[model samples]
Target chain A: MKQYLEIAKILKNTHIVGPYWKLKLSVSELAHRASSGQFVMLKVDSDQGPLLRRPFSIHQVKGKTVELLYEVRGKATEILAKMKAGQRLSLLGPLGTGFSLCDLSYVPLLVAGGIGVAPLVFLAQNLRNRKGLAILGAQKKERILCEKEFKATGFRVKISTNDGSRGFYGRVTELLEELLAKDTLLRKKAFLYACGPRPMLKQTIMLSKKYNIPGQVSLETHMACGIGACCGCVVQTLTGYKRVCKEGPVFAIKELTEEGLAE
Target chain B: MTPNLSVVIGTLKLKNPLLVSSGTFGYAQEFVDFLDLNILGGIVTKTITLFPRQGNRPPRTCETPAGLLNSIGLENPGIKVFIQEKLPYFQKLKVPLIVSIAAQDEISEFVELAEKLDKERLVAAIELNISCPNVRHCTKKSNVKLIAQDAKATALVVKAVKKVTTKPIITKLSPNVTDITEIALAAEEAGSDGVSLVNTITAMAVDVEKRRPKLAMVIGGLSGPAIRPIAVRMVWETYKKVRIPIIGMGGIMDADSALEFILAGASAISVGTANFINPNVCSEILRGICGYMIRHRITSLERLRGAIMC
Candidate 1:
């Protein structure tokens, strides 16, 4: 609930892969408050082209620095990608529900698609003390992220590229199925966590239900206020429409539907 | 001189003229973590309905150039829940609480909501939201898409709610109609203490490549810099038409934009879409207004309110 709106100075914004960039902001008040799967609402530029702040997952928080991994998909990110170091951007964060790390003995199985690895990288970093695995999926090999970071964090890393250029020849869910089926110990003790495209997340939910494994997934959509006030960033749950900003940018897999929540 | 920023809308005296527009600032508790709640002139709660609303389907919002399109469909916990669950929390916030209410299609529904909230001691004023554009079934019987679009409908609802509640009634008007003064005058004649001018103008955007509209509701209300001129114009027109005070809001992002509304004859202004860009925008705007007043050597908001030399 502790949210900070700081003029965070960008220390570095480096290109990681296709359409992906790693941005590091020196805003300690927000960075230090960020948990594993929480996110931030970033104002990429001053009042000009884009009017609303864009939401980004907390990629990592090192000391006083908060990291973000973003894709240049829209006008906001396009403006964000061209910016340099020393330039300051407005940020509101350590916002939203983060991944629950309560199970001390369960193995953390992280699943991500494209730039969705942003929050899971931070989650994996938080779970460094425990044995875990990071599975990343990309349209192709050029878009894969965080293999080295996950490896450095003492977690196993796996990748799946659509063109069969990397770890697996299919989707991340297929790879998840492979791992969950072959490894009995992992199947019993695994706690699945995912963040990615909607279809991918839906498949993850089904996989979790089919295997009876508990997990959480981060939800993303267009939002004006990164707080619960706007009620614009809501996804239908069993309970009704829940704000992705308040109830979660992260939600229990059980709350998700196979398709759009029936209005 | 710091310039007395205080302005009164009906019986409600705001410490400043900078209020956070409804729907833009949730119930106000959502902002407790970002900035001091007392920094605001007033906090207008999201439009409350007779029953809980799930709102529009997914893709509720889209960012257009210099503006935001939202089809939130008045998503809110019903007045009963607002009284029980949301009203108590506002009692501790210190800032004046103005509850905005919307009735689907009945004058009685607005009266009922006002009657229920009128009993609450924490409520400072009641804002009748007759302008929301995303809703359809509510105004279907009247053949008007929105209540505020018709002057007679606007006056009747305002008068009905006014009779049921002792609190000052501020009727919310929309700019989607051809002329806004007609509705503003009707509210004033029907017993409105003040009018909150220019709710979001109806607008829409489309995804050309996908051949799909940007918002799930297809058409949504546009609120931001893009609609500021129109809102200011509506306020100016309404100001000339009615004797009642005007609570101007439509994209007042900063002190300058806020000043524009005041100069256009608004007693106070509401900061809407800008709060999404900066959580601390309300505080920033208050500071900017103080700085402007100091430079102008103005002593009170009375000197600035409707001070524009046309």
Candidate 2:
């Protein structure tokens, strides 16, 4: 998608789960052009103290508005948390490659871990002519995000927590295994899409490979220029080291190297 | 009336004084969809080496207060691939194209790359990068010592490359040394047409909890608004010593900062780290420079170059 540098006006910044914020922005140009799995670089403050713009995945886009789901990780997001409605920010976006919605023949399954649900929620919203299954996981019940939002999108939602306070008392990968084992039809027709920490993604990719299914995974890294100029966000892929900012924040499961999966 | 923004560095002429610094601007293709590439004075492609470099491991960059530390280790597609794959795209650009080259220990390698690029008609000039601090592997050997840090080494490399290429040579100097003016003088005495300073300051950040360096390379180059004052001071000092022109860079974000470099005695300015904040920054800076000239009723940039008062 084409990139744009725009002044996005904040409509609301609301606290969702612990440490999570939903910043709704009135960015018609960016909203109209953004697709699922794409991201925007946000300059949190007007000053140059933070220096670099922070990259956030496009959580949800409805008509002329877009929502960003982020955690207060550092100074930039901390400043974003305090920003009120009517504040303006410099946003550069619809950047990197997004999830492909092609091939409707396979059943869509979204696997999200903790804050990785940001992009999956966007994908769920854009899913048409199909009812997908969303497997959401967090450390505990309080850490789980967007359960109702996923349900609102008409997705069959399943929850897992490390503690026994959610639907399944185990890892999301284990939950995915159970679904595949129980439903022979799902094993044959499922196409998985996942986003989370590296360990979770590796496990999810391994599970997909084991089940003989096709899947895509969204990766993250510390980036300087989200526009591919900096080459800072490179990941070692099967082909070679590819820039996550340009080639993908999204890649097919087969493209990633599985050498360090045990770690 | 539109102010005459054009300036000449040696035999090479630029449309304006605004340039996107090497490394930060990539190949110039990355910003084409966001801004017009023809509006700027020139474009400096990232530093190219004789051989392909994989660069450092993960955590290549980190942010400090108003500064950025990067240990990219000059990751570049070697000269052969650059010519075969990257040069075709740069040749289509209307603006002046300055290619930055980084050499290993051998002066022969520098000459070889220079002779190869000298054949390309699209190349307007060559900027010799002798200042990169991120590459740790080059530090062990005396021959591989950063050329900018040693007067004799700097002269040797510049003289060798100058012998092979007719293109204007601009030596990029490091700021980590004790005296920067001495190195700039060395470049000028070695037949360099111009000099650019300063490459990122040698600095390091540490993860206090982990008790380890933030960058995989242990130390990286520090850049951003934090280094602007030092850049201006070095340019001002170098201007007093060198007869050749100075292309000043380091932490330039906007027009005012660009003007600061010019007034401090830089003939041209390059916006580096700021490009990450705004892709259209070069155009914004160009317009801002024009507005400053029109408001002050100045017709040319010469009136402002080195116009600072004590």
Candidate 3:
């Protein structure tokens, strides 16, 4: 069911996992209907200040509360930074095609980079007894969050940092390669899923392909509507032009082209 | 029925005045699946020309303090290709479709495009664009008589195209003019069935780092709520001067705002920049109007047109 929600509470810094912030909103209508990969469009103003609403992948939904994660960057986000807790925000959601884990039974190897880790957090929580391996990356050790939670939930967590400030001093893709090389049993049956910066995802796709494993990557694009309508968030795939919002922000590794990954 | 929302532009009756403006709405096909296309009065497709255009390079759109700058440069598949390749998609849509056309240097280009599409019964009307002044010599040529230039040019194209087809012709006016009524009068004088006012006002955005223009085209059209007040004034003035009909549009977001345009003398209205911020804006406005009608004990939307208090 589709729902239009008003931002009842803009809870800042709810500390969901690590250094990441959890924007908890009171959106019962949208929260109750959202699935794993569905996202929402958030508006900061009635005028056209942001011009376009920012699309956020639904991190977690429980009862009437919905959550989103974002890293502040440009002017639009700067406005979001100043928003008070009680301020009302216009939200449209439960959009885009979400992840479908309907009838698959293999160990899931999930890779996340920086803020890209946001979407994977809830997925990890949802998968209780499934053997899940999550490799997380950040610039430093302090930036990493939720290691304890993943471990408590039975996910073997692997951490990497770029500045040599934590776990491995290199990228997380290297750690993924190491995992595949070391565990033949895990490599043979594990299904790969990833979300992060474009470069990291590109490398992960390459590594997964080299290891002969099936993989899916979630993409983020500049979007007007979080649903398939606008065609603003189009990504070039092996088949043709597909909207990231509708076709699948999460696409199989084989379905992508160099242009798709590069964008 | 107390009559609250509907309006008419000449002989065409609209359920409500709200429509998606050109360019921002793309083709109705792109959004029809997500929205009830029948709920809107109409949708103005992105500007088309005699030839296909690739448009400008990205970052094509950037947010200003209260608006957006777009240099989309009329990226469409030419009129011939549009009629042959794209017109069929509108068959599934419930509302009427308006085709917006633009040219850089000549009135003949507009005439040629209108003539080509005139034979087909797919589109309901044509919107002639004379407000895009940054595209080279068009500024000097179209600015000579301001609104009359568009009216006269629109009349010629309408007359020529009418010779072949019977669809309505609407001249879309730019907001940069000193006097918009003069242009509105000119359009009525030139045999235009209706007029859509006002198109985006020409404006510029600056990138602080380079201190240069933000858009690739140097200057772009300013749209969204920032231009709403200006549009309402122009529509009001044009309403006083014109004998035909006017499709008022600029920055309509909600039902109350949409009502303002009608009260100011708009026969119908279009939602331009608001769609960018909210994909469901068209449906939202439609529902909002329905709710307002029930609360006010109003029935037909026609009574609300031009009902604003002085």
TM-score of chain A of each: 0.96, 0.95, 0.91
Q: Which numbered prediction scores highest in DockQ against the true structure? A: 1
Ranking of all candidate structures by their TM-score, best first: 1, 2, 3
Give the Cα error of residue A222 in candidate 3, in Å: 3.4
Who wins the TM-score comparison? 1
TM-score of chain B of each: 0.97, 0.97, 0.90
Query: Model 3, DockQ value?
Result: 0.21
TM-score of chain B of 3: 0.90
lDDT of 3 by residue, B97-141 (tens): 888887755666777777777766767777777665435424555
The models' CA-based lDDT, in order, is 0.87, 0.88, 0.73
TM, every model: 0.97, 0.95, 0.76
Per-residue alpha-carbon lDDT of model 1 for A113-224, expressed as tens digits? 9889989888887788687988999988877888889998898889998989988999999999999989899888889899988888888988898888888998777788
Give the lowest summed-lDDT range of ten residues in model 1 chain B.
B136-145
Model 3 lDDT tens row, A102-137: 235688888998888767776776775576888988
Candidate 2 on A1-263: residue-level lDDT in tens?
57899999999999987899999999868898998999999997756468899999999998899999998888888899999999999999999999998477888899999899999998988884377899999989999999888888888899999896979999998899999989999899888999988889888888888888898988877789999898877777777667888899999888986652222
Q: Considering only N, C-alpha and C atoms within 3 Å, which residue pairs clash in candidate 2?
A: none
Q: Give the TM-score of candidate 3.
A: 0.76
Residues B161-274, candidate 2: write the lDDT tens digits.
Answer: 999999999999999898999999999999999999999998899999889888877888999999999999999999889889899999999899999999999999999999
What TM-score should be assigned to candidate 2?
A: 0.95
